[model samples]
Each structure stands twice: as structure tokens, then as C-alpha cells.
Target: MNQPITNAEKLSKLPWSIGSNALVNVFVQLTFLGSVFILFLNTLGLDKSQIGFLLSLVPYTGLIALFIAPLIARYGYKRTFVHFSVLRLLFAALLLLTPWVVSNFGAEATLLFITVVVTLFSITRSIVVTAYYPWAQEYIPKSIQGKYSATNNLFTTLAGFLAVTLAGFVLDLTTGLTGYLVLIIIGVLCGAVAVWGVTKVPGGAPVEVGRGVMASFRDTIAALGDKGLLFFLAGVGLITLATVPLTSFVPLFLQEEVGLSSGNVVLVQTGVLLGGLVSTYLWGWTSDRYGSRPIMLSGICLLALLPIFFMLMPRYSPVSLYVALGIAFLQGIADMGWVIGSTRSLFVSIVPPEKRSEYTALYFACVGVFGGTSQLLAGQVVQLSSGVSGSFYFFVVDAYTPLFLLSIIFAIASLFTLRTVRSDTQVTVEEFAGMFLRGNPLSAMTSLVGYHFAQDESRVVAMTERLGVTRSPFTVDELLEVLADPRFNVRFEAIISIARTRPDPRLTQALIDVFNGTELALSNIAAWALGRVGDQTAIEALRQGLNSKYHSIQANSARALGRLGDAKTAPLLLERLQNEPDIGLQMAYASALGNLRAKEATSPILHLLHDIQNEGARRELALALARLVGDEGHFIHLYREARADFGTATAQAVSAFKRKIEKVLNSETKVLSTLGACADNLARDQLTEGAGYLAQLIEVLPADHYDPH
Candidate 1:
């Protein structure tokens, strides 16, 4: 009795899902997710290692999710998510009691209480999050998932920015644990609003039942067998380890190392959220079409440099605060790509709908293990490096610098794994990186934006034409995207534009798709365009296109094969020429044979020329013969003159024409190019200054075919 949700209904349910995420992001920002919670733990006299374990608890909760996933399958994803969200919030409210416990029970006892409470909250939150992923898979249609990820990030980031800005001032206004109390209270209230929003969104019914613990275990094992999913997880896990530590510790570095106030330290996080707010959508938009692999790799590479930047910042210099803010902002932008790429790669390439719940649980566990371990290690590293401070060459060494350098090394090491992950888009890492570097950035940006938002087919065609004229590699993706337009004119224009660019293998593949597609108009253009842009890879497709029942398609494909000029296809062209009944296709095959330099077809073509009654077909045959023998292209024009009458011409004009043929007959040279033959036979500049040969050419025209008025 399960009914499929129509795409329209799914779209209608999106606002609740995204809006709820935005609200929860505020709660996350104000509470344990960022600076406030870390500073709160630090306020209770807890050292680095103790605070690290607290942060680690978030991921440790994922271990429980491994067991709780089947419950979601039995009860339905949305219900479990809604129910657990409230339960998690109740536990989160216990965080408000931290200062009271610390005031009476001492640091050790307060640490124990906070751990127990946060762990319970984290466990509930993990189950809620595990259910949310499968819920999202159903709630958001595949067509818009890329945009939705970006949109969700955008709104959540704005909410986080606002929350941090508010929390920063609240901490500045009140002293110590009291400010922390206010923030937690606000966070819990926001959490309540977020839980209500989760109830309004639809989908996430139980995918199936009776797939018990053993089946879930098998699914987890089976996921590792998928090379794409495995490699993706490896790349993401390494990156998470590399980047998470820096984000976790940056606030502490600012507060303890650089002399920023608690409020200003919290406000610095706003820079990170602000950077994400600006750039997250861009990462999503590009990765949606360009493939997430580049986005993922590019992000981690950017992140790799940030740790080094942090290592070099002068502690407590006048500009150190500004420097800290800049690095935090840059980290946000770099991390946005990682976030978008990871989320998109999971939905777009890694997990499938049928296995959503189980795979999601595996994802949570994998990320949690990596992230939790990184935080714990980072804290321990901070604790261990406390005595290990000095200057390393030009850099100012501190307890934090070692952790930053460690993050940098791991960030770079993850590159190899990212490269191994497959990309659906054909763009290589070099090409994606070079796209803005080498091309006209404005033109590339304009083309991408115009093509993405283009509603008018005419405007799209115009943009397609302009992009072709730019001949930039960056424009090829947009041009290829246009080839899928439902309107034939738009697709036809895209094919022509693609042909005008430098040869790319993707161009050949895309053209092959259109040539093989059902539309004949696009098929013909795609065939012709393929010959212009395709490599040897395109020969097979063009050859197969010759088998199409439509003469226009066959003719274009044959002509394209000729244009491609691969001599290996000459035999196929000759066979088609000999058997095709259509005069148009016959001409096309003959032309293709000539371009391919198929010397074997010359005699057969001559026989066809002698037998065929059509003038145009015979002309094509003559040209084909000329090409095979390495004669000048102008030989076709000479053949026309010879067929015309010279009976009424003066003796000198007739004599000159006769002399041209006699010289060619006696020439020692075996091959003749067009200009070389023209110079030898006519005036030296006969092709350019036709005035010298105009009289001679006119005199040779048949008296029956020509008359001067």
C-alpha cells in the first residue's frame, strides 16, 4: 500500500526540511558544536584532553547508530527522526546545569556529569541524524539534490553566523559560566523549534521490514565491496581528519595564544560562517555539473595551506587578530567545498536509495570514527606540545603549531585517495583547476551563469554561439549541457558550437550520444560536428551512423568520416559509395573517400562516374579520383574547363589551355597541391588574380552554355 511521492509533492515538502536545518544550525552554533561549548568546558577548569573527549562524544554516538538503524527501518525514518530529535533536545537541556554542577560538585565531578549528559544527547542526535539522511533521499528529488545541498548550507551558514554574533556579545556582557548558561538555554529553545519543523516535512516511510541485524551487518560489509563508495569514504575520512582538528582548536589558539577576549574569540567564528555563507552555493552549483571529485580535491588542497597560514601568524601582534579572522574566513570557504563535495558525492555517486538507511548508518559510523579520533588526538597533541614551544626558523612555534602542521600533512596525503575516486564528469583535476586560471574568467563565468539560468531558447543559442567563438575549454561543459535541451534548434546550435572548439574526447562522446539519439536533425548535426572535433575514438560512431535509415544522417555521417580523414575508414566509405542508391549519399561517400585518400577506390569511382547520369555525382567522382592520385584540388575546375567548348575561342587562348595539359602529362613530379598546379598551368597568381585567366576561362565555356549580354 506504499504510494510513490510525486516529484511535485517532494518539492512541496522541501521548505520544512531546509528551514528546520537552518534553525538547528543556530542551536548547533550556540551550543557544543563550536566555540561556546569548547570555551564552556575550558571554563570548568578542564584541560585540553578532557575537552577533547567531550567533543569526541559526538562521533562516538555514531557507534550506537550502527545498532539503532534497523529500528528506523521498522518504525519509518521520519517518525524515528522526529521522536529522537525531541529526546536529544531533552538531554541537551542538561548542558544548562553544567555551571550549577561546577559551582557545587568540583571540576572532576562536573566533567563526569557533562560527559554522561552530552553522550546521551549525542546518542539521540545520532539516531535522529541517521534517519534524516534516508529521509532526505526521499524528500529531495535527485534532480535538485545538488541545489538543495547548497541551499541548505547557505541558510544554515547564515543562521550560524547570526547565532555566533549573538553569543559573542552575550558572553562579553556576562562573566564566565553565566553567559554559557544563557547560550545553552537559547540553543535548546531553537532545538525545540527545529524538532517541530522536522514534523512538517514528509517521506521517509520504512523502506522494508524483516531485514534484521544479520542483514544490516551484511549490508555494511557489502558497502565496502563497492569500490566507488569505499574510495569515497577513504577520501572523505582522511580529509575530515585533516580539517576537523584545525576548526576544533582554532578558537582555543585565539583565546590562549593570541590575547583576544572571550567575546571577540566567539565573534571570530562568525568570519568562518560568513565565508561559508558566501561560497557554499557556488561549490554546490559547480560540483553538481562538474562532478564532486574535483570539488573535493580542490577543497582539501586549499585546506592544506591554511594550517601553514595559522602556524605563521604572529601571536598578539597588532594585526594578529585580523590575521586570525582572515584565516578563519578562508578556512570556511575551503571547508565549504569539502562539505558540499562530501554531501553531494554521497548522494550523487556513493549511496543508493534501496540501501539508504543501512549505508547512511555506515556513513555516520565511518565519519564519526574518523572525526572523533581526530578531535581526541588533537586534544592530546595540544596537551603533549604544551612544553614543546620555540621558534622554528621564521615561524613562531607554539602548542598549536604542531597540530596545524599535522593537519597540513594529512590534508595533502588525502589527495592521492581523492584522485583515485572516479568522476562522472570527464573534467580532470588539472582542467577544473585551470578552467578559471587560463580562460577569460568573465566570459567563462557569464557563459556558465547564462546557460544555467537561460529560459529563452533563442538566448541560449546566442550564448552557445558566443561560447564557441571564445573557443575556451571552460565553455565546453556549458555547450555540452545545452545539447540536452528539448528543443532541436538549441541542441543543433550547441553541436555546431562544440565543433568550433579545440578537439576534446568529451566532445566526441557527447556528439556520439546525439548522433545515436532519436532526433534526426540533431543526429545529422552531431555527426558532422563529431568529424570536426572527434579523434580516432569518433570513427566507430560515425561509421555506425552510416547505417542510419535516414539519408540525411547517413550522408552527414559519411561526409564527417571524410572530414575526419582517417585512411582506415576508406574501405568502408568506398563500400557505401558503391552500394548506396541515393545520389546524395553516393556523393557523400565519394567525397569521404577522397578526403581519406583511398587510392583503391579511384578506378571503381571512375567506372561509377562513366555510368552515373547525374552531373553532381560525376563531379564528386572526379574530385575523388583527383584526391587519390595526389592531384591538385583545382584539377576539378580543370576537368570542368576541359568538358566545356573551346571551338569559338582564339587560337592563343585554346593553345594556352592545351599547353597546360601537355605540361601536366610530361611533369616529373608525382604529386600536385592546388596552388602549385595552378601556378604551373595558369598565371603564377591564377588563384588570387583571376583577371589574367578570366579571358582564357571564358573562352573555354561552351557556346551553348554561355553568352555575354
Candidate 2:
């Protein structure tokens, strides 16, 4: 369910989607896949491996949708989803009869009944899930996919929290089959509500899908072979392989190794839900504005740490409970980041819009396959490592230790695959982590979440100013959003604030796009922002900007190109300055030429210096000549002193610089000697010792030339 702030229609339906998600999670978190389900099964004399098989079977059974997708696509994903969701709900209700089946049929027969019931339910649910993605993809607007996912997660996680808490209380009060039966009834009721909510949202009509089943198969084949898509899937698969085990076994590890009571373990597990609730919006917002790859990488990194933490966690103590809760909270954050990033990245980064159905099928199937295999693999490890008790340098090892070790290894491998997966984002995982590490993490999260609260111009300006003041890379998303605000003053301030952060491709491109805009003020400031960012990618755009009709735009573009040091445009600057009639614009072009150290520009600037009537403009041309010939300090001193007293050390420095220009024009025999002199003069500035002063002069503009006040 997408709740795009600007889309009124989508906003109106947001509650239905969120409510539906909450209901579904309530059902899920109580009966079938929830902790209550596992505990109930365990009390029935089922072993861990058998429990893992049942849990793993849910995702594994999703493979049935692969062959039936064309039918689902032809019949309409929404209609099929709603129809099957109802059927699945009915099947979920049958679990209420499990106690009777056990009493009548004996233990062997009971497992068969449960298995058959769950298998059928899983098949129908798989169809609903597989069809749901393309439908959801069509239903949700692309811009808010991350927000939509995160927001839905928030509601669903909250509902799950209540459902799990209820189940915990019910089981505590009523033991054996009666407690599970009550839980199943509640789950069934929640499922009914979930099914009702799904009908409220629009768009799930049948698409004009491929004609044959072979079409989906062909697409799947192509997806598996395509290097880029395949590599991304590989990354996703490795990550899935790494993380599925943690959710499956970590609770068991806490109970067995950490010496937490079953009741305390449930409370400890609430931390995961809390963590997810806290981070849901922030991760979604970040992914939507930024990209999902970094979030995914960050999730992997966080998951990679848990194994070590688990190993070092003190056992059988009050502190162990808190420690386990802290680790579970981190796991919750990792879970949100992983799911939101991986799933959203599928649509935005991996899949083509037209091929959403085709790609979504492959994406889910990849996760399903890896997810199923990971469960079985993790179960085998846990079983095999049952005798793995030992101690190594303060770290405790147990049957659960191998699962943690495997998780760590798989997480590390997933990172390498992440690096290979091509993404449009230029930011590395390290940079994204560093943003939080270096800046105020709490401030960054609060500002990002509150970004949309700025409804009026005043609030918008205040938020934009905060972003600029914080100067964190984490604030770049808000800055990008603000840069597009309809309010002129808001956009203006955003550009200025963007100048304060490190140069980013997204920010650089936004500035370049604004630079090419028709708005006079915005385009001018955009030019200045690009110069401040100093990204070479904007050089061509700035060069195009030099042709703008507004004098301010032209001057700012010329100066920006100089700041960017696009030396290729120095000759162009010289030509524009030579033909320019505007005094201020001439000064700007001269400044650019000077900054570029255009040796040929030295002679032309010297020739134009005497003809310039305004004393300020004349001195500007002389300064340009000084820079072009590699004399910065002297010209700066002379340019300032000439207003008070022209004949002194300042005069001598100006004269010496002028003598080099004289050789370039009139003395052919001394041209090489003067060239040597210019080279020698420029050498001192090779590391740009006086470059700051030069920049100071260019940025200020000739106040006498432009500002009447």
C-alpha cells in the first residue's frame, strides 16, 4: 500500500493497505509461522529439524506459482490474489481442528494432516504472494516504494507485537491443545479481516501477459543468464542464505545457551519488533530518496556482527537477558533494512517497468529457493554441531555456534557479491556507514523522518536551513527533495545549503539540472553550487550555461567553470571577454581566464587593460593578466593598493609582471625567457598556495561593476 504524500488517491487508500498488512501480520505472528506456532509444535514432541522443515516449507512451496503465473497473470493478479487469499484463510481455519485430528488419528496421522493442511495453504499463499508483487508494483507509485514498504511494515510489526503478546499470555494461562486452538481461532479471525482489507484497494486487473507458459520459463531462463541481473540475484541469494538462519534459530539459541526462561525470551524477542518499528520509516525514506544497495549492504554488515555478539554473550545470567534483547533489536533493524532494501531494489534497480511481472517472478523465486535451502542447511548445521561444545579465548561454542559461524561467513560473502552488483548509486557502503559514524545519527534520522512535516514555506525553509547547518551526507536526501519544492525561496535556499555537503553524483546532477533551468535566480545559484561542489561532470553543463541570456547566469557560469578548472574552456573565456561589452561580464570572463592560467590570455588581457575606462574594471583586467602569467600575490597587493597609492612595492610587482607580458607580445627573442619566467612564477602556485585568495576575488565579483547599492 503506497501512501505517497502528494498522490491524493493513493493517500486515501493508504489505511486499507496498512490495515490489511496489519491484519495479515496478526494472523501470521500468532498461529502458523509465529513463535507460538513453533512452541506449540515443540511441545507436541516434534524435534528442531522437523520444525525447521515445516517452517522452511512455506517459502519453498512458493515454487508452485512459477508454473501457474501465466494463468494468474491472465486472470488478473488482484482477482486471483483475493480469491486465493480467501481460500488460504479457510485453510488456516482448519488448523483449529488439529487437536481433534491428534486425538482421533494418533501422532503419526496428526503430522500427516498438519503437513497436508500447511502444504495446501502454502501453495495458495504462494500464489497470492507471487501475484501480489506485480499487483503491488502496479498499485504503489514508484517514487514511494520504500516509504510504502516501510510504512506497511510499521503497522504490520505493531499488530504482530500485539498478536504475539496475546499468544504469549494465552499459552501461559492455558496449556496444551486448548491454547493452540484459541490462538488458531484468533489467527483465523485476523485472516478474515486481512482478506476484507485487500478488497478495498484498486488495481489488480489481469495484464496482457505472454501467451504461453513457455514465455515465463523463457524469461526465467534469460534472467538466470543475464550477467547483471544474475549477479544481483546472487547477492540477494547469499544474503538470504546468510540471514534466514538467524530468524529460524536465534530464539532457540537464546533459550538453550543464554539461560533465559521461555517467558523472558518472548519479552527479549520483543526487541526485534521494537527495532523494526523504530527503523521502518527511516530506512524506507532513505532508500526512496537515496538507493537501496547501501541499505542492503548496511544490513549485511549489521547481521555480520551478530554472530560474534552471540558467541561472546554471557550465559545464564540477568545480564544475558538484556544482552540477548540488545542483539535481537539490532537484528530487527537488520531485518527491516534487509527486506526493504532487497525487495525495493528489485523494482527500482533490477527490474524494468514493462517487465515487472516477468522479473518479480524471478526475484521472488530466487529468494524462495535460497531461503528454503538456507533453512535446511542451517538445520543440518545445528544438528551436526550438537556436540560442538568448547571454549576459545573467551568465546563459547555450542550446537548453535555453527549456525552463527555459517551466518557470519555467508554475510561476508554476500558483501563481495554486493560489490559486483551494478547500481546507479555512487556511494559505497563504507560512505553510508561513515555518514552515521561521523555525523549525529539521531539528528540525521529525526530530520529525515520529519522532512515531510514541512507543509508551508516557513517550515520548509527551517528544515532546509537545518540540513545545511548539519552538513551531513545523510541530509542529502532531504536537500534533494527541498531542491524541487515549488516555493522559489525554498528552492533558492536548498541550492545554497547543498553547496555545504561533500560532492555527490545525485547532488551534482540535481545542481546541473537546475543550472540548465530557465529560472533566473535558481539557474544562477545552481551555477554557484556546482562550482562549490566542483564535480567535473558539471563542466559541460556549465560550458552550456555560459551561453545563457542573463548576464548573472553567464558571469556565474564563467566563474564556476574557472572554479571547476575546465581549462579546455579558457580560450572560449578569452574570446567571450574580448567581444564582451558588459563590464561585469568582462571581469568574470577575465577571472576565469586568469584562474585557468591561459598564457595566451595574458597578452590579450594586457592589451585590453589600458582601454578599460572604469578604474575597477581596468584593475580587474590587470589582475587577470597577472594570474594568466603566473603572478598572483603581487597583482593582488597591487590591485588593492592602486586605489590608495600606485607607486611602491605594489607598483614594482605590477611592473615586473607586466614585463613578462611585454615579452609575450613584443619580444620574440625573449619569448622563451619570459615563458620560463611565467613557468617559474606559476611553479610556486602549483600546489595552489595563493589559490584561496584568487577564489575569494572571483566569488565576490567586482562589486562596483554589478551592485548599485
Candidate 3:
């Protein structure tokens, strides 16, 4: 039997609400660096071959960073942020130092310069990212983490647009050594700023603290235990690999084959960036509001179209460049979708919170391994094609054929991973009621087992609600066993029923195991259950869903987490609140937080209220916030503040409640005319009509407010 819900359940939810800010900072840094990458690369003297080789080195170096993510998890995000900033600073400094190092050492220093530059950038990028990735997983509510991740990416994309334009102008102003020096200086300054920005944001407590680096590594590797994650990585890897050919060589092809000018090349790149900026945010917002799977599938299907479009570019004009840009935009959407779908939140929800860092690090390691090989192979293909004689266009297109075909195959495979499973494993309805009423939880559990054997899934779900009134031990076992039932329907019914009743660790584990397939019913229910559970174990699973390719799953998850309530989740909620344009989701989040008594959620909640055009929702939220506080003094203060301002539904409720309390406590009471009039105004809305009754009782109540407002 599970323990009864308590104050601590609500408190744990608070942390999730607060730690999302750190992730926003990290994503912003990603955009800032990406925008300036080409400008920085141009400043180097390496030939085409050297540049390709040097670029390939980036992933290998990144692999090292991925390797150490466990250590960062052990030490805490605070230290991770420190490591990230220091490494980035070093990388930025190296960019400026590269020219001098080359000048001093001559030809002998060329390889060394490339190595140092790539090494520095790689290390900084990976370490910061490793630390940053888990921030969302650790803090943000699973329900909305997708949206938060997407919105954060959207902000980063906006930053990219601004940063690229500025970097381009800066590099354009000067020539040769002076120009390079200026770029290096700016890079250093920006890197430092990024680090500073991240450190300023508060982070969640490190779940895996003070472990040895090796132990951390072991944990990260252990994340592969989840079959869904393993397959998801494989599918995502193929997609990334498919993209490498275009992402790497598109610029060079445009410059050489199309005979375009440097300015035009910049324009093309800018166009691509703009596409990414728009698409990433758009998809992210949608993913957060909906779910990750649908969004992911949509993006993948669109990606298949890119290659076919690229093949048509041979006979096309500058308009074809637009087509290419559109394709890049679609690619950006897919990338964002992939990020959400593959979030560590998904893993965390399935696995225990104690294992989150280990899983995250392992996931990143897989990304690096697959992503690096793809880059190398892509570079080799491009290099080989460049040496071949006839029409470079056909040769390059042919080289990419395998990748495109593979992406299509994996995309189809991803559909299989889209099935939804139940949120937790628990007993059915009749069993629960029987257990509580008869004081025989085992009998109640047996009833559920009998129901499962009979395959009465619908009745099972119906009965689970009745079971929720009590928390019994045998009920937990019944629930766990139900999830392992041979029949899919039986397991699905059992999982969802448990989610509605209470969270079970076994249920969490089973969901991870069964997270594959195209049926989203189970997954959606499970997501909702995890959100309600409000434990660290479910964080990664929820985080992964934030960028879920499906809008529905993403939205439901966000809404669920908002209700779960944790301080760690506040910052992430705020990030989504700031960036997403979905009105419905915004309302759901406000309501969920209110119901969860998310005290620390005030800032973000208040911020959302400022722009809310919906009067009804705003008023409801105001009242809900008061209810959430559940403190007499605070409630009375809220009542007084609203009452003094003017006539509104909220004011009437406060006034009426005030009167009712006063009359009950004091024999002789006095009626407040303003409160009476307010109650009359409130009676028009059915939702607030109850306020009228309280208004009549205000005449005799005592002055002191009740605690359970």
C-alpha cells in the first residue's frame, strides 16, 4: 500500500517550478555560438580539407564532454555551470590566440591551431550542454517541459538572428588581422556573458550528488536500460545523419556550383537561420501545447521532402534558394521536435529520479557517438565527390541518396514508437473499493486480477476511481501485477487506474518498458499520472515529452505537471508562459498551479495574468490563487484589496465569505452595505452565485479570519 498524500508532495513540486530558468540560459548560449560559427571559421587559414577535418574533430571532443556529464550531475548543476563558463571562456580566448600561435610556430603550428580551436569549442559546447540539458529534466514539470524546451529554443533562435546579424556586421567592418582579432574578442566576451547568464539562474538540487566520476559514468550507461530510449536514439541518429550531408556542404555547394557571391552566401545562410528561428519556435510552442510524437512524425515526413526538392534545384533559379531555405526551415522544425521527443524527462519519468543524471549522460554519449560518425562519413563523401570529375551536383546528390533513404526508413520506424502506454501500474476500481470497505486489500486486488482475467478493461478504469479513496499495500501489488498482465488492454487499464489512484514506482518502470508502439492512449494517460505523481523519477520522461512531436501529449503533460506543483518546476513554467502563444494551455497551467497550491509559482502566474485578454480566466485565476494560499490573513487581504478597487466577481466572493464567518462567530452583527451590493453583482454568474449566501451572513461574524479560506 502507498502512503497517503501530504504537504511534502506539494513541496517537492515547488522545486520543478523554479529550476527551468537555467535551461533557458543554456539554450540561448547555443544559438549565440551557432550564429557566429561561420564568421569565426572564416577567420582561420585552414584549407577546405583542413576545415572539414577540423570540423569533424568537434564531435569527438564533444564525446569527451558527454563522457563527463555524470560527474556534473554528481557535483550539481551549479558546478556544471561553472565548468561550462570556464571552458567556454577558454575556447573564446583560443580563437583570438590562434593567429598568434600560428604566426609564432609557422607551418608546424597549423595542425596544433586547428586542434586547439576545435578542442576548446567542443569541450565548452558539450560540458555546458550536458549540464544544461538536464536542468529542464530536473526542474520543469513533465507536462509542459516540451513547450518550455521548444520556447527556450525559440528564444535561442531569436537570439541567433540578432547575434548573426551583429557578428556579420562586425566582421564586415574590418579586414584581415584586425577583423579576425575583433571577432575573437567578441567571441570571448559573448562566451563569458553566456556563462554569467546561466550561473545567475537558480538550479534544482542534484539528485545524484558526490558520486565518483566513474560511478557517474556507470549510471549514465545504465540509462540505456530503457528500450524506448534506445530505439528513439537509433531513429534520431539516422535523422541527424541524413541531415549532415546538407548541413555541412550546402554553403560550399552554393558558393562553388551556383557561382554565388560572398554576400549572396551570407544571404543564403541568413535565410536558413531565419527559417530555423521561425520553425523551431513554432514547432516548439506547438509541441509544448500538444505532444512530441505527432510533431516529430510531421517533421520527419517533411524532411523526406527536402532531398526531393534539393534534386530539383539544378534547373531552378534564385527562387530555388528559397526552396532550399524552406527545406532548412523544415529541418529546424524536425530538430526541435526531435529534441523534445528525446528529452531526458521521458527517461526520468520511467526510471527513478536517482538515476536521471546517469541516463542523461548516457543518452548524450549515444548522440555524440552516432552524430560524430555521421559527420565524418559526410565529410569523407563530400571530399570524395569534390575529387570526382563530372557535374558536382549529380555526384553530391548521389552521395546523399543513402542518407535520405535511411531517414525515410527510420521515420517510418519512429511511428512504431509513438504508441501511448498507461502512466502507472495499480489496481482496478472494484478491487480498490472492496479493499477499503471490507478491510481486505488483498481481496480487492484479487477482484482486479479477476477483472483483468475476464478482460473487462472499461469497468476496471471506472472502478479505479473508487479505489483512490484509500491507500492500501495489497492495492499496490495488484496494480503492479496488472501492468505486467499479458493482455494489452488489461495492462493499459491497470496503468491508467493506478495513475488516478496514486503513483507507484513499479508503474513508472513498466511505462518505460512499454513506451513504444503507435497507440497513444496509454502514453497520454501515463503522462497524466506522472504529472500527478510529482516525483523526480518522472521528470526525465516529462522533459522528453516537452519537445514531443505530438501537440496533444505535450499539452496534456504540461497541464498535468502544472497541477503537480514543485518549486523546481517554476522557472520552466515561466519560460513557457513567456514564449508560448497558446491561450488554452496558459489557462490550464494557471489552474493547475492554483490547485497544487504552487506558492512559489506566483511570479510566473502573475506575469501570465498581465497579458491575459480573457477576463473570465483572469478572474478565476485570481480566486484560485487565493484558494491556493489557503491562509486566512492572506485570503482576507486579497478580499479587501479586490473589494476596495471596484465591483467584480472576485470581490463579491471575498465579501460574502467575510460576512459568513463574522455572523457565525458573533451573536450581534452589522451588515456592510458595500459587501451586500457586491454579492448582488456576483449572483449573475452561476459560478459565483454561492457568494450571495455568504454576503447575508457578514452581519454577525467575528473579525478574525478562518485558516482554511
Q: What are the lDDT scores of the predictions, listed in order?
A: 0.79, 0.78, 0.56
Model 1 misplaced regions, further than 4 Å: 211-232, 421-427, 456-462, 469-474, 481-502, 505-709
Give the TM-score (vs. native) of candidate 2: 0.71
Q: Candidate 1 residues 597-659, lDDT tens each?
A: 777777667777888887767767777777876675557556655456322222234345546
lDDT for 166 in candidate 3 is 58
Candidate 2: give the clashing pairs: 76-206
Model 1 scores a C-alpha lDDT of 0.79
So what's the TM-score on candidate 1? 0.71
Candidate 2 lDDT, 125-205, residue by residue in tens: 888898888878777887888989999999888887777777767766776778778888888899898888889887777
lDDT of 3 by residue, 1-709 (tens): 3233343442355333333333333232232234234434544544445555666655555566445765676667667766766766666565556567668887557667657767776777677666765664554555555555665656655555554455456545756656546645655655555555555444534544566676666666666676766666666566666655456555555555555543344445555556655666445544443345545555565666666655545423656566555655665655655565445225433445655566566556666666677667766665555544343445334444444455456455644543332122133323322434543454445554455455466665545433433344335655676667666776676666666555557666766454433568777777776776555576666656656777666666666665555445656655665567777667656666665566666766777778776878787567557656765466656566655554454655556665774565453434445345546655444334535545554533444642333
TM-score for every candidate vs. truth? 0.71, 0.71, 0.51
Give the better candidate number (1 or 2) by lDDT: 1
Tell me the deviation in Å of residue 480 in model 1.
3.8
* Clash pairs (backbone) in predicted model 1: none
Those runs of model 2 whose alpha carbons end farther than 4 Å from true positions after fitting are 1-14, 207-219, 353-358, 422-424, 449-451, 480-709
